[model samples]
Target: MTPPPEDLASEDAKIPAPASPDALRDAILSVAAGDADSFAGLYDATSARVHGLVLRVLRDPAQAEEVTQEVYLEVFRRAAGFDPARGSALAWILTLAHRRAVDRVRSSQSQSDRDVAYESRANTQEPDPTGEAALATLEAQRVRTALEQLSERQAEAIRLAYLDGLTQTQVADRLGIPLGTAKTRLRDGLLALRRIVSAPRQRKEE
Candidate 1:
């Protein structure tokens, strides 16, 4: 386990605006060797870029800020395994930030899906062939229209996962994205559907 950065030398804690690649690499190495002060320097040098990448992926400034902190903690623990031959230190750090951000988005989306699913199940009605046939047709039409409200990727995700009965893993593979991203798309698509479906009810109430 990496120790906390509290005991680091105050003199070395000050970070430059944007350290050179060589400088960043050296700081990572120092952190790997249990130099907290060097990790602070690395954090200062690359934090904005890390946060920006996370924000682009997540589109939530609050979540991006939280994930940026996680990225730095991960860097402290994993810096020992970094191979400069594989990539630049900045690339490695940004990759971690992106992954963490995606994970958060996926988790949040999955929870939303679950909530929507539970509500749907709770509201399920007993079948009436005469009424059911008409309702099913109407529901199908509503779904088709609602799908149109999604973004292109979200629509594709919904078609692949729900309509085609593919698992999330399968959708991820088909889309060539991480499973987290696939879940996020599906979640957003479902949320859109829920909103579209509810809009009529809201209008009637109003």
Candidate 2:
């Protein structure tokens, strides 16, 4: 069976020490042409420095190790894109390592920010029993104040029809009044309630 592509760099990975700048550049160019032996030589020449740079930026040994493997794989794939005329081969490799490490840091931070925002929204939207009770108390006060302005029969009709959930005909029967008279009392009571509710706001605006 054929070994994995990563094993290609594993063969002579630790066989040789570091190479000179020109020799490393030559090896990188050879690896660009599909030379597995030269890639192993290139890995031997720069893997330590690349791993160290990644470790320093990431600050986690396990994550650094994972990123180091990714950097070498990137080097294997992008060796052909290197331009010696622009810079040395080691400089190109270190650039790849640093960029990968910083990207991981940024991705982790972004995920953390999203988690915090979701938690904040969840807490804000949760129902509050105290606040709901306070709102109900304020509404009851408004209804009581509006009823004071209505006639006794009108107030009684509205309470039976709306607050007690009675039908209009039932309100008329309970009060011993006609259906039309009950409807007229409910309508007048509602108009008076609207006027009383709006009075506070209109006064504030004026």
Candidate 3:
């Protein structure tokens, strides 16, 4: 056959510096049994690749640092479970790194999805309408005055949910209020908006 592709030869050449599975196994055993230098060497050998994997999944430098630290801690805690006969030590570390990266990505995605839903929910809730041009202008002023009349916590909840496009849950979380309290604040704020808009006309008629 013609010579294999040069790139394939090059790829094979780039394989990690050969690490003897037997030596790795001995190191794991040595570290688990409390040979401090073996454990330190373990950190020296694996940190770069583990950190790369963390940064890929987290896409945040700070989070990558935290996650990498967690990976090393986990390795130290669970090293006794390593079964060297089944595979290479590097393979084990790589597997753990892969799992941790996937977990971090999934968590980030979940939070992102929650934030989007909250935004959509906040955008959909509203108030009332008016009759005259004066009524409309007064309605705008009343809406502001109504909002201003609320308790600080109540006003914040309404602003977050109505003006700023946050979910009730998000408002509650941001304001440190209970979920039931957030709902009650929103309801009360809307009620105040109605009364304020109607009050000027009620007074003029009288």
TM-score of each: 0.50, 0.50, 0.48
The digit string of per-residue lDDT tens for model 2 on 1-206 reads 32232333343344344787799899988876666667666766787877777777788876776677567656765777899997777778877887888878887897799689878787656445678579968977887787888889878976886566566667789999887677567655655555566678679999
RMSD of each: 18.1, 32.5, 23.5
**Tens-place lDDT digits, model 3, residues 1-206:** 11122222232333464445577678777765555556656766666666665675677776676566556545765676888786667667766766676677787897799689878888665424436556847745655677887778767776776556566567778989797677567655544544555567679999
Candidate 3: where are CA atoms >4 Å away?
A: 1-19, 119-206
**Which candidate has the highest lDDT of all?**
2
- Return the TM-score for candidate 3, rounded to 2 decimals: 0.48
Which candidate, 1 or 2, has the higher lDDT? 2
The order of the candidates by lDDT, greatest first, is: 2, 1, 3
Error of 3 at 80 (Å): 1.1
- Per-model CA lDDT versus the true structure: 0.70, 0.71, 0.63
